[model samples]
Target: MFIRTENPQTFIKFYPVTVAILVLQIAIWTIYLLPLPSVQMWSNLMTGFNLGIAKGEWWRFLTPIFIHASFSHLLFNSFSLFLFAPALERMLGKVRFFLIYIGSGLVGNIGTYLIMPLEYMHVGSSGAIFGLFGVYVYMVLFRTDLIDRANSQILLTILVISLLMTLINQQVNMIAHIFGLFGGLAFAPLLLNKKSDGF
Candidate 1:
């Protein structure tokens, strides 16, 4: 529910929105790729839902999206963004795309903080990535003609596979993924341009 197509001129002007996020991620990784003296790189600066929240670090909720656990983690999520985010920007306008991206990820973090084991620390953009998938699925269901039917089906399959794989991987934060999906469903109302029932 996060985006509506805008004028081509606006799209061109805002195209850098997605690029800016990518650049920030890359820049952070570039400087903090290796572990430091006490911080273990910049992770202490960036964490998902963790005991840090209890410590009164409220920023913990949204900060983890930028603190990826490993190169592969960042790589896959970044590639996914590269594939999905650009189209979303074009469709929903850059501002709305950002709303969906960050908002869904925040929901995932909140879910992890309240529901998951406090000892486990999560770090990655997978939650946000799943949120993007949720939006795409919603589009396929209600706005089928707005996107390619076949591609939508393919993306859905990919989502399922990713979920199943995560189930097998103990390191992945399944709680965050699930919450992010719910976030997408909840956010659908804002994505729509019409006055009709958002569902």
Candidate 2:
């Protein structure tokens, strides 16, 4: 179910929300990478800095979801979003899917704000992507009817590997990952209720 088979010519026709998000992420990353003083300053201002948030730069929480530290960072998150998000977008429809994605990212950022040190700085969509996994986790555990066995197993394997990587990687913001997961899970019941029949 996670595998994407959408035709390139019509991908945006079917999944406009997912395509829009991908475009936004890439555009933001491009702006960040450009060798321009104004854009560099904007990128710095958008990073998830605990001190900045604490000082009332509240938009930091939302902007960081589209910011990435490097090409690999953008590629990994963007690829993950591309591969997995369309299913949820199609299942949940555009508005609910957008809410879950952004909500989970917000939860991750707010959790980071509360837990991390003032000097801590982070930029990526890992938290939001993990939130998508959390929705899949909810399906595997409680909404089995919404997911088949093979997909469940595959998601479980990925989840385990992701958790292992998160634990092993010293540079990862483990707090955001954990919180983003729970955030997706927390949003699942409300957003997913009565929708299984539709899917």
* Separate clash counts for every candidate: 4, 0
Model 2: per-residue lDDT, tens digit, 36-126? 9999899889999999998999999999998888888889888889988888988888898999999999999999999999999998988
**Per-residue lDDT over 1-199 for candidate 1, one digit per residue giving the tens place of the 0 to 100 score:** 2343657666446667777787788777776755666555356757764787988888989888877777888898888777677767667766777888898899999999988877768877778878888877787777765667667767788888988988999888898898887787667657745532222
Q: Which runs in model 2 stand beyond 4 Å of their true positions?
A: 197-199
Clashing pairs in 2: none
Provide TM-scores for the models.
Answer: 0.84, 0.96
Candidate 1 backbone collisions, by pair = 1-191, 2-191, 3-92, 4-92
Please report how far candidate 1 places residue 93 from its true position, in Å: 0.6
Off by over 4 Å in 1: 1-14, 34-42, 195-199
